[model samples]
Target chain A: MSAALAVEGLTVGYAGAPVLDGLALAVAPGEVVALLGANGAGKTTLLRALSGLTAPRAGRVLLDGADLSDLSVEDRARRGLAQVPEGRSVVTELTVDENLHLGALWCHPGRAARRVAVARTYDLFEPLARRRSSLGHQLSGGERQMLALGRALLARPRVLLLDEPSLGLAPRVVSQLMGVLRATARETGLTVLLAEQNVTSALSIADRGVVLSLGAVVVDAPAAELADDPALRHAYLGF
Target chain B: MDRLVFLLATGLARGLVVALFALSLVIVWRAARLVNFAQAAVATVAVFAAFAVTGATGSFWAGLAAALLTGAAVNAAVERGLVRRVPQGSPLPGMIVAIGLVMVLQSALGIAFGPRHRPMAAPFDERPFVVGGVPLLSPYDLFVLTVALALVGLLAWLFNGTTLGLQLRASAAAPEVSRLLGVRVPRMVTLGWALSGAVAALAALLLVPTELGLNAHSADLLFVHAFTVAVLGGLDSPTGALIGGVLVGVLVSLVTGYLGAGVAPLAVLALLTLVLLVRPAGIFAAAQVRAA
Candidate 1:
């Protein structure tokens, strides 16, 4: 009934030290929200909290207005919230096709519909489609990223969370893949929340951009304005 | 020629038992990514349990089922309590645990059943028949062969068809990613151990009846054979383990018949050593298994 995602006053850490303190953001259906922050900025932690991978001591994450604090990681995924987890999320031993199929494993009863979603995932990442027989260990980094994306999309999530899609990729490959992601968002009407170190590229596709310095939200504005804001860009993004 | 046929048939059946045990290793390797030095120990425990239960109840099927369940339950508890807590823990730790299990299980059996060998009930009552005057074995071979084949088929279907199976594969391949995806990595890991125990029990149930009695020495020998088969085939490839088991079984039988009876286990170990020298990754190693 409400937005696809809403995080209010989130605070999380592994030990006692807080990494993400009072962080907040929300995105409606079909919206693209870019979370831009430097290293150690708790962007990854915030994403983890939202997907129910980590328990936050404070604040709430609402997925379609449902509080996801108590849901297990699998339960959150089952509720149509999927994350393209960092650093080789694709099961390296499984073939590309198997990884894609497992993405829909989160789809419990609507599994048949999720199969259609898997087919769409293959269609979305044609390189993965071609090398369907390859395992994650056998894939190139770009192919691995595409495979990771395909795996997440199979869940048919309303909100697709990507952690640094552009990381370790060539500029051309990153731009090309980013375009595909943006197109998928427009065509599928799926809201996307991506945390990126690539400021210029993220702003190119995002409707709105949120900047974080340390753990708190420092800037939330129109993507174009944030991109052009010299003061914010120089101070936080190093762009 | 008749003598040769007799030896081959006997050896082949023996090999089938080894192959099934090797299959247990394969299941463990696929799920836990550990070679499970304790597989033989688990199998030995199950065999003893089966003998005790079958002797008391006088029903083979009931006893066998109980043994397999015990194996699963024991392995599940161990994985959840002892093994699963250590993430990406080395295979060495598992091997150590397995070695420790050998002592504990052996001591427990010794206390309960005594150090002396105990006679076990044979699953089949059929005697070997002379078919076409050539000493064809009792078709008990047929039953064992069929069960092992069915288990293989079931595993293939489970890995290929079921969602839980996919999660299991994913968890083994990438624990961190699987965690992020919301899979209880520990739960899948526990399931892996349960699988290892179940398969080990099944293998032991099929195997123990072929011999005169159940003893720790015999169980330890079975582990050596299964381990050789697992290593020879490629730790990750279940099919390879099966082939390796059969090959070792037949080879050992032939050598014992012609050369010497005492050197068969050594021969199998030599063969596995050769395999390792050639391809340390294993003949049928999966990508992740090879990478590791």
Candidate 2:
């Protein structure tokens, strides 16, 4: 079963300066939550903090009611916290299959099991299946993003964090990618926390929306309500 | 004709050793993106450890095992203790640290063992076998070739077929993304250092018996050739390292055979200069010119 993720008073920064100061948010099990904000709104920082990439200065990240504040990134990932960072980070030296293999490394760590997991991922994303032997650097931008998403799915995480998955993608490609994501969430009940700039498309698949301005949540409501509120949308999301 | 055969045989044998040393450098560079200037120094210390073990037990195998362990331990310690403290995204600081390590290790070895040559007996008889009226490869040369090939094959398999290898490669290329995928990137980097140290020890052990003897600066000459191979092959490409090692080996052997022993270093320098002028990135780098 997918698990809930709760963040309370999460503060994170670099070089003694706070990027995300005293922020709190909650994601229910099997929920599709969109994190929307302008540039430098600390969406990436919040995702990094949740995935244990950036250390939080003060707060607790409760995963299924367990404190994950002290865990390492790998340890946090082992307990079902997986993240796909911004910029379509494909390991250029590795092949598509190898990238998917890494996603299963912490959990499976065995040849037979990892192979099976990779096969399942290929079934989910057929384009990646065809290009299993292709190096990451050889992949097109859209393919790279698909490879990243497929790799994350192979981990079987309870909650997946995606940072700017739709950036630099064509409109048709973005819609197609989001369509697959929506179906994947519905079928597997996988919880997702997606940080995105494409507000319209992000809300299309999101059950709830949380808007951040200057590292603090200003609008937290149902996706439909947040989308319908013209005043709030204009002020925070820029329409 | 016999002299040609002998030079070719000896050159090929020496080339294997150079390839191993170059491969070691390539492994470390691939994993951490830092050239280890102190590699020879690290191997010299391991040789000293082997020397001590061989003196105590009179068993070359036991000494070899000890040296391998010492080499791996030293490199892992360097990575975790010293190298990790430096910030990432820049190789200058790490390079400086490695250069400093080289000086310190050489001085320490000189103090402990004195600045004199020490004989290191090969495990096998060093007599070349006669073939077609020509003395070609010695049993020791054959052993070196076999071991080098086997180690290279094992490493190739490790990097191509294993999960740890995948993580190591991925971690080296993109640490942040690898971390996101649950790869313990730091651990993998440390493991790469350990593997590199062990391989560097193997290179030193092979080359020392062929040298005048073991000394504080014995591996320095070999390190120069190996460094040339690393640069010639492009630091990032292992295949480049292998081919570069062979090219340097054969080049040195042919030059010494025809031109004279004194002119070999000049030949290496000339070749390096020519390659720099023509293909600065390397023979094996992608066609696009990489930025400095």
Candidate 3:
């Protein structure tokens, strides 16, 4: 089958500093792929390139089967391209309900229907549902992550691009979040391509794994196979 | 008792004017986190337009319309041309440029109109009524009060209800986020400046009849009153600005009516200093912006 999301020959930089240089990767439909790399390995940069927040120097980032190059950020969002940015990207001044409404801003067929969709996301992440009245600023680190995940899902994207979902969380919270991710992918067939630093947990939940070294993919294999390979573990996962 | 009452009554009337001026200040601040220090000068330019047009036609309505239109046009031009040039520059530079523009605007108006006092007809009648066996107030005072209240309500609704208002509020709270969300942030700022200019013009239009007269000096010190209102109300809230305006107006009127007219600015300056030292947010300021 054709790849659900693909990045080929991606080149991106900031202020003349080339962070991601001619990188390539792909994720099949309904698959969960973990992008594992060390800090400064252009992990976050690649995700940003995919989201159109960072303009690539040269590359093609495909969503489903279409090119996402010409679309504006909000336009890209309306077309079901959602990015739960590294730092929990929540609107602090807005109430949680208002933030959720913003997530469904593009789901224009019917807001009542979208509200039901948001409610499902709430059910998936019960902690976020409980704190539905709270402000984004008031949520704890773990709660913020759940809220971020919940928000991205509300956009109802074909494939969800999550950057560093496991950052600054308890071990159990990370596992719980991973479980939610795995379940969402299995049931919803929502393609997911995540860049993360939490090696063990990401590999545990993901079906496949891609390791980056100096902005180039060095290894791509089945998650279970990579976990058992000791040599690959030391280079990328520090295991 | 009579001295106290007269001072208080006079102060109260002028307080309404102060309130209108303050409301204008707050409206601009809310939309763009920058203080259009040039607003006072812009108002002067707008009032000049009002004086000439009304003075020529001897029609208060004509002058008022002319003044407001001119304010909007000037505001639009400045925002699109000058302000847009330095859209994301440091605040201090923007402020300096505003002050410089004030001098330029004043000079431009002076060159065109000359330093002259022109007669402007009052929008309302000169009849006074007896209340408490004293000349309580004239129809003119009533008219000012009505105008102030109406402008406040209209703007309040505009800011809260309209799409323009939503864009302004969203832009004010988070410019980057709004831009990322595909809002044309520059257009929002332009609209905000135009709104502030129009309101300032409205305030000036009311003032030129009696206390302000038709000179360039007309509403020159009016800005001081506006600043007091804004500071008193808490810089963030429009409602606060209105209350501040009325408070300053009444306080100034009372002081001038009883003690002396010259001490009003001093009293306002003192009050603002107190509020800053104590509350620092007006009556409603939020967490201070720091170097991030």
Candidate 4:
């Protein structure tokens, strides 16, 4: 199958200094690729660049061989690229249902379609469904992550970029989230590029691993090999 | 007893006009998170436009429509061309720019209209309707009250019941997240400004005829009350604007009736300070948990 997402010679930075440079990576359709990196390793920057949140200083991003270098973040989202940023970024003042409603706005779904999508999301994340009327601030961290994921799902994106989905969740919650990710990939053939600091758990479900060090790919290999490599783990991941 | 009832009723009607002005401030705040100091200037310009139109066409309704359109256009222009350029976050620059706009707009109106109180006729009779020898409400007062209520209701419906409104609320709350969700945040901000302008125009149109006349400074007094009302209600909450506006209206009316017109401003300032001290977020601010 053709690569769903491709990046070449990507350079990104803030205030005239490059954070990510000459970054190249590709993911096949239906693949769950864990983007492993330590702090300041350009993981978040890479995802932000791909999702059009951050403009690349130089390089091209291709989704299904279509160049998306010139699109706005919202335009990219409409074109089936969605990102769940760190901190769960829920509109804290809005009700859980309202936040979900915002997700369908990209598609401009009909009332019936919106209702169906929301109901399906509720089914996937029962806790969110239970607190449908609760304001965004009222939800637990796990529920917020679920709500964010569900929101991304409602957009029916082809590729989902998740930035540190396991940041603050409990171990059990992270495992549950990984299971959901696997199930979603299996059912929908959704391509996922997850950036995470939780190395062990991230490698458990990721199909392949792409590790970044100092903004360039250090190791791009199958998940098992990357996890088994003691030297690479010690050098980059520090355990 | 009859005089007291009459004063209270008139005060309530006056308050509705202030409520509309407060609502305008609330709309802009919700959308762009700015106080929009130029709101009175925009309203004054709209009133002058209405006056010019009414003078030429001899149609008050047509003039009112012109005012509404002018308000929307001016507000949209300000948001698109000026306010949006001030950069997001930290409302101080936007406020400073708006204050500058207020000065520019008011001065322009003063130069164009000669800074005199020019009278515009109200569509309905100004004489109060009487019941059992009690003056309850004038036809003009009722008209103002009705128009304000209808406008507020429409705004409530627009905000709570429509997809566009949902997008607006989301856009304001988390613009980046909303952008990620595919919302056109800039467009929503413009829409918010337009809505605020229209409401401000309506409040100005209704109140100017009752004032000394249609002049550049006609909206100044109304704005002070409206600003107080907007603060008394949390800047972000619409429901707060409504209740706070009416409360201010009643307080002002009672103070004017019993303590003389001179004491009304002091009474309002005192009430505002007390509300600020007691609940810094305002009575209807949902951001905080409601006290029992």
Candidate 5:
């Protein structure tokens, strides 16, 4: 079967210096891939480029064997590519319910369908349900992450890209988040490319681990092998 | 007491128009993050289109419909063709482009239509209704009031009750996140401009019949007062636009009624300055500033 998301010769940069230089990777459908690296490892850039937020210098991104070169960010999203961006992704001015409704906007056209999707999300994220009327800024860090994840999930995307979800969250919160992601992936067969600095938590849920060093993938191995190899973890992930 | 009542009544009618125009500014600001300096010029063009339609068909309703559609179409075109090309990292480039557009549109209008004011007739009677020997709202003023209230109500329902409104709000607040979730952010911005243009056109249409007439600069004073109202109510809040428009309207009416017409502009300036001093964000501004 074709890879769900394929990146070839992907080079991206800022002000002339390439952040991601000639990177190539492929993620199979329904596979949970942990993109592990330290800060400035081009993980964020890769996700952004794949989602069409950042333009690639000399490369192509393919979604299910379809080239996404000319597609706009929103067009990429409409084609089942969803990203939960790092740091305060929720629209802080809007209430939690409003944020979720936005997620279901294009995916679920009918009002009834949208309502059902929103209600289901609220049920899954109990904290969000309790604070339905509350604005995004009012939520705690973990709650904000939950809201962001919940909002992205409402899109019913085929491939979900997440950036630094475990950043600045408590251990239990991270575990809870990872658990929800794992459960959702298992139930729905959702494909995920999760970028993370929290190696242990990411590996716990990811089926495969792709370690990056200075923008190119240094190791593409099973999640179990990467978790067991302490040398690989310390060198690339800095754990 | 009778004079006060008359002034209040007159001010209420005038304020509704100002409120409507200011609400347009608020809509554009929320959607595009820039005040459209050419709004009055754009609306004037639509009113001119209404004039042509009214002249050809001899139907005021046809003219009204023409104005609304033309306003929305022209504003959307401006956003897509001109405003979208400029760098949007800061508000300055967009504001400068809008100001330039105002000059271009006004010059083109003057060249085409000449510098003469055209008399546009109102659909309803202008004679005030008397209640117990007290002069009150006229049929025309009542019409304005009803239309203003209904439009406001409709807009409120659109933004708060519909999925499209949710996308507009989300895109404005967090464009990147909205895009990630499949919301068409640029299209939403264009729609915002269209909505603002239609509202501005309606305000100009209402005011022209009561003013000197429809000229290239007909909506100039209205734009000034509406801008002030938008600022007084906080550019981000629709509720602020409504309240601020009314407040500015009444204040201008009372100042013109008691003092002189010359002093009304000064009073508006003074109110704007005072509001800026007290609350730079406007009275109805949210407590927390939106994250950039």
Candidate 6:
């Protein structure tokens, strides 16, 4: 099977210092890959680079065999690459309904189709339906995360890059989010690259885990294997 | 009593024009996060286009269309050619560049059209309609009111009811996030500039006939007054611009009528200061400041 998303010799830097140096990885279709790392392990940078937010110093990001180096962020998104960026990604001024509608702006051309997609998202995330008219800032952390996920899913993306979705949430909420992610990936056959700090929860849903340290991958193994290895977890994941 | 009524009526008409222009500023600010200092000069350039077209075609309507199109095209060109090139890490550089643009545009207009004020005749009759034994809005004033209100309503609909508006609002509020969601944010920003330019041109087109006619500097005062209105309304609020425009308009009219023409600017300045002191964000500012 071909890789749904692939990165080759990816090197992203700010000013002079590289954040993601000589990184290479691949995720097959319908696979969930947890990107585990410590605080400065370049997990966020890799996601940003993949999503076309951060320009890679030297590398190729292939989305379904197409080179994404020249594409702008919106163009990349239109090609079914979506990113749920770290921290409060929602437009705080917009309502939950508007935010979801925005997600379907390019993909769903017909107004009726857009409305149906939004309604479907609301059904999938019941909390969002209850607060359809509420502003983005009005939602709780868990609700905000759900809204972010719902918004991204509305894009019907081929590959989803999520940055720290479980941040600032309770453990139960994190698990619930993980379960939804796992179910969604399985049901939709959606490829995912999840950048996370929460090791145990992330490993729970991930088919494989790729650990990074100082801009390079340190461990690339099965999720269960990484989860069970205490020394590996302590050495890299900081759990 | 009759004088007060006339002043109030005239003030309302002028206020609507100011509101329309201020709303233009609000639009550009929301979309690009930059206060376009050259808006007045850009509008003046459109007015010049309208002037030339009206003079050539002998039709005010043709001129009106010319103004709207020229304004939109020029503003879009400026955004694409100049404003987009500047460092966007802060608002100050864009503003300074805009200020420079203002100087260049005004100087260019002065050279092209000369310093003389060329009279652009109003499409409608200037004679006021008498109602209840009192003189009220002239046909021209009524015309201004109709156009301004119609444009405002159209813009309000565009921003609140349409898909493009949603994308624009999303682009304005969170540009990076909007981009990731598949919104062509740069295009939205350019569209914003185009829309603002058209509106500003229309406002200037309406106001010039009532003032000392068209000149290179015709929109300078209008820009000042409209800027005050935008700040008074809160840079981000369209409703604020509408209300603030009328309030400032009435205050200016009353001050000019009772005090002197010179005192009008001072009154606007004072009103702006008071609004700033009382509510730094403007009267209708959003409850939460968007994270930059």
Please name the candidate that would achieve the greatest TM-score relative to the true structure.
6
Better of 4 and 5 by TM-score: 5
lDDT of 3 by residue, B110-162 (tens): 78777887766786775657677766667887888888888878887886654
Show model 2 residue runs off by greater than 4 Å: A1-3, A14-17, B287-292
Greater TM-score among 5 and 6 belongs to: 6
Docking class of 3: acceptable
- Prediction 2 TM-score vs. true: 0.95
DockQ of each: 0.50, 0.59, 0.27, 0.54, 0.76, 0.81
Question: Which consecutive 10 residues in model 5 chain B have the weakest lDDT in total?
Answer: B283-292
TM-score of chain B of each: 0.91, 0.95, 0.91, 0.96, 0.98, 0.98
Q: Which stretches of candidate 5 lie over 4 Å from their true place?
A: A14-16, B289-292
lDDT of 3: 0.77
Give a tens-digit lDDT track for model 4, residues A1-239: 66999999999986456789889999999899999989999999998899888888899999999999988888899989889999857888789999998898757468888888888889998888789999988889998998888899889899999999998899999999989988998899999999999988889988999999989998898999989999989988988
Q: Candidate 4 lDDT, tens digit per residue, B1-292?
A: 9989988898899999999999999999988888999999999899888988998999999899999999999999999999989867678999999999999998888888786788888999888999999988999999999999999889989888889989988887888889888998889999999989999999999988777898888998899999989988888888888888888888888899999999999998888788889987777777643110
Tens-place lDDT per residue, model 1, A1-239, is: 47889999898875457898778888888999999889988888888888877789899999989898888877787788888877667677888877777766655346676667777777777777788888778888899998888777666788889999888999988998899889889988989999999889999999999988888898899999999899989988986
lDDT of each: 0.80, 0.87, 0.77, 0.89, 0.92, 0.93
Which one wins on DockQ?
A: 6
TM-score, every prediction: 0.88, 0.95, 0.82, 0.96, 0.98, 0.98
Candidate 5 local lDDT, residue A28: 95
Question: Which pairs of residues clash in candidate 3, taking residues 3 or more apart in a chain or in different chains?
Answer: B11-B250, B11-B253, B15-B249, B19-B245, B234-B282
lDDT string, candidate 5, A1-239, tens digits: 99999999999985367899899999999999999988888999999999999898899999999999999999999999999999879899989999888888888889899999999998899988999999899999999999999989999889999999999999999999999999999999899999998888899999999988888999999999999998988888776
